[model samples]
Target: MKKLFTIFVAAAAISAAAHATTAFTDAKDAVDYRQSAFTMIRHNTGDIGEMLQGKVPFDAKRVQQRTDALAALAPLPWPAFSTPGTESGGGDAKPEIWADFKDFTAKADKFQLDAKALQTAAQSGDQAKIKAAFAAFRGNCKACHDKYKAD
Candidate 1:
């Protein structure tokens, strides 16, 4: 019975995610969703960065929370970028992204991988591991932005 209940919950969650992925009816809607996701990502990233840099004292639980958020949010924006007409939605994204989508996706895949790595490091509660993983994860942003994002 518990197994059946767990399966049912998983099914429901999948249904909800499907609904969300299809909720955007236009470029603007897609852009809005993606921007929202990025905002959350930035907030969590900022907190983690601050803690790591000694601007804020390290809080293990908070670091884990932020890393977990980063891992979950990292994958949310890519699909929206692929949404039809998102190019015209007038965000910071540059045309180079669409021109070389393959490259952009590769960078995005790296970003997600780094986010997961940071999450794992945070989970292990090792400050040294977190610092190294965070550096790699944060570097992914600048590399992508230098080519794909507008000033």
Candidate 2:
């Protein structure tokens, strides 16, 4: 029974790894995955921005919802960027993304950290704190886009 359980666990681990790899099976698949993630991030962040700018009412529940969504979406695209041929997948992602991979990763880390901070602030139900956190998060986004994304 012990041996059988070990084999089952090994198989489950392998299947999980395979599932992760299968997410970016080809260049186009990688690009599409990344683009879709970014699209979702943009939509969620846009709603947050609208609330921040007074274009929409500041609802604690909605702010939490949007920021939580952004936190979840933030890390999904980076792995897709690792697929070969994704550097020039007819997207606005600059080639420097790969050439300066370390810097890109650092920027991505900053963005993720800020995103989490925003999420935490939103969870506190404090509008001013959320606004401050969002401003910091937006700076991270703009810094990365300015360096890595093409117009």
Candidate 3:
């Protein structure tokens, strides 16, 4: 069961990444792309959180799968931020994202780094390490969202 779940998670992540094309011909396409990428990121992280919180069993392989997905997905949303109307396009993104582009990119880069750490921890199969890495990754996400994403 664990192996199957791990395989499924990896397969799902690969499929999503494979299908995600950066053909942002327009603002709407960009918005959709970022939205889908973030949704996938959230889902994958939530899966790891579930295992950490014991809502699901601690399966190291599953953790690796989800974290691997997250590491890959983390960088996908930033390009969309450069698209037009990203701030006012009926999305939750705030105008500060563009106004403070340097800060935003820094935050995004931090998130990507933290996500990589989480992926490494997941691969290590140490629950304590995974928990700490997950917390750090979540903190990075929250910092960016607080500054850039609207309620």
- Tell me the spans in candidate 2 whose CA falls farther than 4 Å from its real position: 1-23
lDDT of 1 by residue, 1-151 (tens): 9999999999999999877766265788788888899899999999999998999999999999999999999999998888888899978989999999999999999999999999999999999999999999999989999999998
Output the better candidate (2/3) by lDDT.
2
lDDT of 1 at 106: 99
lDDT of 2 by residue, 54-86 (tens): 998878899989988998998888988888888
The alpha-carbon deviation from the true structure for residue 87 of candidate 2, after best TM-score superposition, in angstroms, is 1.5
By lDDT rank, best first, the candidates go 1, 2, 3
lDDT scores in order: 0.92, 0.87, 0.85
Candidate 3 residue lDDT tens string, 4-113: 99999999999887557442446666787899999999899888888889998888988898988998999999888787665655678888878889999999999999
lDDT of 3: 0.85
The top-ranked prediction according to lDDT is 1
RMSD of each: 5.9, 4.7, 9.6
Give the number of colliding residue pairs in candidate 2. Answer: 0
Model 1 TM-score on a 0 to 1 scale: 0.84
